[model samples]
Target: MGFLMDLIGTLLRVNNLTYRYSSQDRNLLEKVSFTIGLKEKIGIVGPNGSGKSTLIKILVGELTDFEGNIEKPKCDLKIGYLPQDVSRDSDRILLEEVKAALPEVYKVEKNLRVLEKRLENDVDTEVLRDYGELLSKYETIEGFQLEEKIKKALSKLGFTKDDMKRNYNKLSGGEKTRVELAKILLEEPDLLILDEPTNHLDINSLEWLEEYLRRYKGTILVTSHDRYFLNKVVTSILELRDGKSTIYSGNYSFYIYERNLKEKQAWEKYEEQNRKIKKMEREAKRRKIWAKRKEKEKIGAKDKGFITHRAAKLAKRAKAVETRIKQMIEEEKVNKPAVEKQIRVKLETARHSGKIVLDVCELSKSFGDRILFNSLNFTIIRGKTIGIIGPNGSGKTTLIRILLGEIPADSGFIRWRTNIKIGYHAQEQENLNMENTILTEVKRENSDETFVRIVLGCLKFSQKRVYEKIKNISIGERVKVSLAKVLASQPDVLILDEPTNHLDVHVREALENALADYSGTIIVASHDRYLIKKLADEILEINGKETKYFPGSYSELKSKVEL
Candidate 1:
């Protein structure tokens, strides 16, 4: 990986790393080599099934039977790894859990207490030395202000003071992830490895994390599908493809540009090689023709021998050229770049809804005393993409459900015009039937098997894949199934809740393009800023106290919020 880039302050080195699952025929990671720098913010990027998770697992010493060497510069190096799935089953409160993040710190603190107690009785040389050494260790680990640091981190990560007192078991999945993340940040490991860390984070928490990571004094190796997050946080990118690592000394945007440039250059070289091969073949054929013509000519009987010799030389030269062409084909040919996998679906909407698609008046909703949103008033026009954004518990889903008439608003007027057919794509893909095959589920959209198959194909579902049950497929494929269903419905107003969740960058880009081309009113409630910015013309920002309308793109809304 350091073939061209500077390798200053390298923290860890991965050399000739290769791994294969027991059931797999081919190695998932093949000779992957990369150098992680000290205090460097680097990102790991690849498409799904590119062995990103496998690589992380190997790096963290989860799978030991892999062929590779991971070199750590420091003997006592500490690493904090955050995987996609986190489960902490504990009865302890938030503060206690975070405080106990580094159990070694507790040991240090306990030793310091004992040393201090001994100082009260014995003031010997050995005792003082031990105490001084322990104190230095404590300070190095930031044990003195540990609690304060934990509290500050918790607050920044959207944890309330009351939440700190709440039981860890009581917290939701996202809340638990936050608590876990805060603990990791507080612990301050020398090397932090984050895998899909932004999956559960809200927009506010994401912003906070970006800033925190920027200021963090630890080396970070993070893998995420969030391009925006990678762009903001990572200084360099390490892209894994075909079990190999390609390094880029810049963020996600730079990586994209470089990757494209490299692919273009590769294509150019391959085409040039093909052109040269064709030219050589043509020249050899022309020489052979010339030799045959010279041999056929019986002019100048005296110079007949000379003509034959000339023909023989020309034939020999042609044969030499043919041999050179064969050697070039065997040795000097450039491999063509593989075609990228991308969904090629077009979402078309029916023009059946009225001019005023939806009108909400004085929408107020509260669970007990906690008001989620109050006095929400807005009118959604036809053929406009509206982005609904809010915090985790700020009623974005509730508002969406209310608009879809799945949930009742406390005091609101949801006026839908005539012929307004609603097509909803839920975040969890609840609309899909787990027991049903993908083909069966998609067939529900269109009874015609031929049409359904075509749609599924466009969504990157092969003929064999269509028969697979929904539960057997990956979350990303399930998302595509949901899209297929939604497309078949052909609703006038399309409502997608966190549509980009669990999607790879390529699929997300495809979805964005389709949604952008959709002429119907698109209402999307998502934490995906990239999707929102690309699609939304206006924003419905639901903060618990007030549901405000920002009549601009997500970037404009962000600027206003910053102001």
Candidate 2:
């Protein structure tokens, strides 16, 4: 761990940090303290709204407020940070943009090579010194083979060399992220901070990024939902909980192990202390009874003052011990339960009337002559959970809208069962009633007042929450309310669009389990691989006018698609 020690000695340190947003009720980061060692890869993990992104913002000096101190080495240590989204110039070629990361380095390398050849046999001291100086500058920038490094970085991120010549704006979101990642790698910073770096990457590209991060010389702090990537790249994990940071010595897997162990130990200690206090209290009560009996017998001992005094003293001592025992019993510490509640909907949906709930025959959809789906045909059946997954703008949302009868297919026939009832959890449904109270919104969805309360209760919304306006609620709470509306409908078929957007991992798991137990047909469009794996019985992948269906979970789809 030589690198660790060196990093501690002259590296980046954040001391007694605290940050608060003006509109927020509490600090986003409070008294957070951690150090990033040179060449150490750290993963910052937390549930949503746990200050992960805020911490990164603090590191990059994006949000400056009441804080403690940030220390770094006196030397010029460059840092490169990659945001979750990349806004690149669409008019410029991706390769040309990536190459612009190190213009000075390239120029220095060019000069060094020219000098080396010019003074090949001059044997002049000044010429040699100048060439050596240029070479030093080039080496400092890692410019000896810049093109080769850029190519390698891009290729590892699942982008071919030909992709580099494409216009940045013409590329998809995933491609833009890859190009941005390549540019950051070319910068060769001493420290790198990446926020949701895997957001737009596929399985192959994510794995490539993980491998590249492992071999990278710079220190890295990454925020990501890709558990596999975290387990692979990070040597240490920094978890933000309740506006505080907890550092784990190992990777994400090890963090879970240590957290569970600590919780178990706390619970055991709490139970043992409670038991000891109860036993001590019982013994004290028995002693008090004996002392009381002795006092009653001494009541008639008028001549024996000494006996009376001794009896009185014993009673006093007994009372003091009893009081101490009572205090001990009442002072037993109890730990908070290390568990969370999730909204679980046991959807009591009716069976579909026909075997084919929905059948699309030669379906085609277009927007301004840009055909999204051309001659697409698919059959959705009862008791099936189908997941539509693809990159952004791949017509997954459009297809869902068409099936739900919200939009018309350009040229196709959509046949449904005789009396199919549809339940939809629209992605933007939460935005429908910003001015209404939660109770009002639910009542609007379904007029049954008691059922509205029951549904909200199931979603973990309290009575106080019901009275609160929708505009005042957090995004997660609004999402739950939207989900509550869907549950209240209890339709024959459910269509959920990116349902995991604002939910925590626990809630997402709850939804997955509930969906698995549901008996009716379900169609969902989601990018959450973890959720899709658990709930999706089949996967329908839409790629640029071609639709492919694989009969299994997302993992199975990966195998089939790769084949």
Candidate 3:
């Protein structure tokens, strides 16, 4: 045992793991194997429906009944998991919610409730004594200072004193995530697992979480689509593709470099293997024909016995070889490169807009007495990309809506010149009809089925997948559907909000490339720094109180930001 620890010290190993849903026809994760080192920060990334979340659930024991062995480095290794959609009652107070997770406080509260119910039926010395004892137990657990302790935990996550009284449900999605993360961190577990942790966090909150995690003492396994976040926080990346695990020993940028090289090599091997397979198949067919001809000739031969015997032997050998080839083809077929796992989109514009796409002056918006932003002024040029960035609830979405005329700005002078058609992708996917099928959603009033299908096929939707309801598909698939509509429009201007929210890295890169190649004006509001860095030529930074504009790449804007 001592030697084992010395060789693979504090490693959590998963061996030959396989799992599937009860309703599925095949295994979602088949024979997947990987290991987590002590104090290692690893990011698990893959396209949607590739079993990243399934593997996480299996490791955290939320899913049992799988065929495999999970060997923990320590017998009592504690794991803390923060799942997707940790949002609960928004009406609950912050302090109460945090304290509810304490087992001791819950026990005392349970006992007090029992005593109170008993007293309602009949008062007795036993019930009174039990109630008083539970109260004393609560006091012993430092009940008076419990709120303060919870408050301290929340404060580090950027919560204020006034926020404690505010409704938890009313907070932005990013704030809700922070509140849930605080609960998980209070457990002080040895392994911290997070799923889609950056799905809602703003740029500021993302940086804070990345810094906090870099200084953490425990092992971290996070699944996220934010490439920049993964590059900044994790030392290694575990990619799940085709029901298998491949671990890269560096950050996301390194993984991309190595993965591209590996993919090129894999594709070369695959093409060569396919050629060999075709050759073998041709030889088998030729031999089968020769055996038949030999039999036909033997039927008219003088020495029929010997000829028949030779033909039978040759045919038997050929049949056995054919069976072997079939088995090889079925078992040894090489998987294609993962880079092929992306949507094919070409964003084209039919007409050219004027030099000025949008002109705005003295733009201001307020919801009740809370000012989201005021006196915001910015100009968008034709054929240029502008990225809108800000914290959650800081007027990023509101600004997009105001420009699209979906919502009204309190006071502003906005002018749109020389642009007729506009394609918009909303953050919440509200533009899509949830009840319709994916095929139906992408079909326009005048578009034919063939045209719509061709568009969906470009988005990687198979024939059967296109028929699935929009609500039944995964979030990534839905994003693709929305994108299919947006690209099909061929508008002069495009505006997207949180376009990369639920996309995997492959699709995100595809969207980025399509937008980069597009020769039209673009205004996108997103927290994906990588996308902004890749596509944006100008940056509009909103901070709830005012707006700051920088006419450069995202990296240049960051360099100009003061510490």
Candidate 4:
């Protein structure tokens, strides 16, 4: 929600950069050339294993079997790289770990001060030389208040000064990413390459990071699945595919619009070329037949020599026409990129339930001495959507599991309406078999072949994709496959726990559309504001020992809460 730093100019230029890993048969990056302008934010987007990570590694000087020159602004152009998966050894305190980034500079300052104190006592030449070099290097890096700078960065990233003393090992995965990000920001690198920076971030944290990056005055190259984040932060889109990067000006939406237009133009050209080729071939055939007949007549009239020459010339002209049409088709094909694939699947609840889908009485759950929820009561009616929302530690998920009978409550009475079929998407992987294929999983639940095909089709699964092993699929695909199974069973009630994870914005929008049009009862525990706003007919605010219900949408609830 802040103005992005404007592009100042090119800070790092990569020229004819070609690289292939030791095990790869072909070049991972084939003579790719691009420039990261000063203060510009570029997003590198592509499917997995499309060389996004490998390319970033090369840029940061991590891997160096490269065939091209990387022209940096300066020899010591400070570069900070944030990799995916922030794992920390919990034993080290946070401050100690972050301070390690500047240990050499810190040591130099200490030695310089010591040398200064001993100057009156006749310091050795070696000591003075060492002291002078250290002083110069320290000043060059602006080492005067490096600690204060580190603390400031960390604080902005959501860590308090008190948190600096906590052990890194004790922090969660999200916390570790934040700490690592803070360290990178403190380094004040001229170029920053972030890979999936928003992976583990919550909505609040994600917003904060977006604001932080918007204000950052350095060149950034980021790859993320968050469309909102991409549109908010990226100035341009760099699509990496087939060992090359293509630049598209403007934001992600602009890129999509441009790409769609390109595809449409290509399709139109392809059709036009096909029609012309067909017409040309037909005319060439008819002319050859007519010429053959004429040549036969000429042969009869003793003019065979002239007829042969005319026939050869006509054939050559036809061949040239065919070649031109083929070339046009190929030209159109070359620039076309594969668009997003959608999986379609339908859920048929074989059995229908009574009006009341779920009945709960005095549900109480606790973990050890900590009571997550106490004396919670609720009811879910058919043909209604109830959204469960609260802080991360709240028992939204716990309540859903208890209703599904997946987890037992310490004290509760949950009664399902008779003939109630349930389609549940659990937060944990209990309902999924990683070894099964997408089709197999759906088939197991619903044995009808026609039904399975319809369901998979509805979820946007193509015939080829239905055979893919579940383990090999992306999380978004897996979620769809899971939904397909639920649909196959035709449950009267659907209970979902954070169903939006691993979903792209497009897929999420599609899912929202599907849910909005569904007739069955639905209950979901989620923190996605967009989803809650678009889908929820009622808000069930779950606080400890209490569940409050408010009619209308999340907007209405927010308005009331703010008041």
Q: Of the candidates shown, which would achieve the greatest TM-score relative to the real structure?
A: 1
For each candidate, the alpha-carbon lDDT, in order, equals 0.85, 0.77, 0.81, 0.76
Best of the two (3, 4) by TM-score? 3
RMSD of each: 5.1, 6.4, 7.5, 6.9
Which scores better on lDDT, 2 or 3?
A: 3
Ranking by TM-score: 1, 3, 2, 4
Clashes of each: 0, 1, 1, 19
Lowest summed-lDDT stretch of 10 residues in model 2?
1-10
TM-score list, all predictions: 0.88, 0.75, 0.78, 0.74
- TM-score attained by model 2: 0.75
- Candidate 3, residues 1-563, lDDT tens digits: the string is 01123344655999999988999898888888888998789999887888988888888888998998898864567787888866567467776667676767766776777889999999999889888888898899776676677787677666779888877778777777778887776655778899988776778878877887888777889999999999998999999887888899999999999998998899898898778878777777777787888899987789998878877877777787778778877998786665665445455686887788889999999999989888878888888899999887788888888898888999977899853678898876768888888888888522667766766666567888888898888877888888878877778888998888777887788777778778888888988999999999999999876789899989898888753
Greater TM-score among 1 and 4 belongs to 1
Best by lDDT: 1
Model 1 agreement with the true structure over 1-563: per-residue lDDT tens digits: 11112344778899999999999999999999989887789999887889998899998999999897998764467788887887869998888888777787878987888989999997989999999999999998778888787888888787878888999999888788888888777767888999888998888888889999998888899999898899999999998888788899999999989999999898899999989989989999999999999988847566898899999999999999999999998898788887565445455666656778888899899999999988888998998999998878899988888988888999978899886778899888777889999999988877978767766766657789889999999989899999878876777888898888888876677677667667788999988988888889999988676778988999998888689
Per-residue lDDT of 321-380 in model 2, one digit per residue for the tens? 778766765675565555454445566774446788888788888889666878877888
For candidate 4, the per-residue lDDT at 504 reads 56
lDDT of 3: 0.81
